[model samples]
Target: MSSVKKVLEIQRETIPYLYEFKDSKLTPFSSSIEEYKGQKQAYVVYSFNKPETEQGSGSRLLYTRIYPNESAVRTTGDFNTELGEKKENFTLNEIKWSVYEINGTPNIHLKGEKDGIVYEIVTQEVSLREVKELLATFISN
Candidate 1:
């Protein structure tokens, strides 16, 4: 009897507090702010996955954003929107401490400190169905 080989491969990259999944060449959205001379400090975190068919286009699979000291995750360009082209902001604070997904949509999870208080932020987006299927497979095995 002969046995077949099953292989699972995942590619990940990190660059200065940013993370990219799937294709390495895809651009990640990120930004930050610094305080000087007792001035107020601010920070921003964002990322998204480009569509497989379109490269360098603004069509994103999962979009996430976080402002300094925010307790909720803000998202734009959700999949559920008509035509998936609307750039509206949505917030997710139901779950804390983790970025989660349901049926392909993504919820970005983050943590930050402000005014001596630590809080968690979770942003949600409607991702492509294929992405959800891939996640399901990855998790099942």
Candidate 2:
């Protein structure tokens, strides 16, 4: 189970250095991605400067409720591939778009159904060193 010790809101100017992010593994991200947000918990997302990119466009921000001892859930719509585009293996289906997990418990669905759909992905425990590499991958000028 995951816990949100505190809900710390970080302004854009105060965004943590990409090098400072620790924990959580860096999943294979698209090269078109413009920016990414690495939160303490909650959810992760990226936004695009222009419209979007199929390779690695949009912003990636990680978000989670900073509740103490309470499990938090993140939901994505997968609409228009705002968060990401369809992979070579995966197709866009109601079931494929949803992200549900147990950390939220009873009825917490990551990538909630409706706004788009929900695809529950098990977040692998990440090491600080590994995070550094992820930060490097998401870099764009």
Residues 2-81 of candidate 1 have per-residue lDDT tens digits of: 11111011111111222223434233344333333433232322234556675543444333222334233233443222
In model 1, residue pairs whose N, Cα or C atoms come closer than 3 Å (at least 3 residues apart or on different chains), thus clashing, are none
User: Candidate 2: misplaced stretches above 4 Å?
Assistant: 1-41, 47-70, 78-132, 135-141
Question: Highest lDDT: which candidate?
Answer: 1
TM-score of 1: 0.26
Off by over 4 Å in 1: 1-27, 34-42, 52-141
Residue 47 displacement in candidate 2 (angstroms): 5.4
> What are the models' TM-scores?
0.26, 0.19
Mark the 10 consecutive residues where model 2 has the least summed lDDT: 1-10
Q: Candidate 2 — what's its lDDT?
A: 0.27
Candidate 2 lands at a TM-score of 0.19
RMSD of each: 13.2, 15.3
Across 11-69, the per-residue lDDT of candidate 2 in tens digits comes to: 21232321112324332232111222433222333221223443442233332211112
lDDT of each: 0.31, 0.27
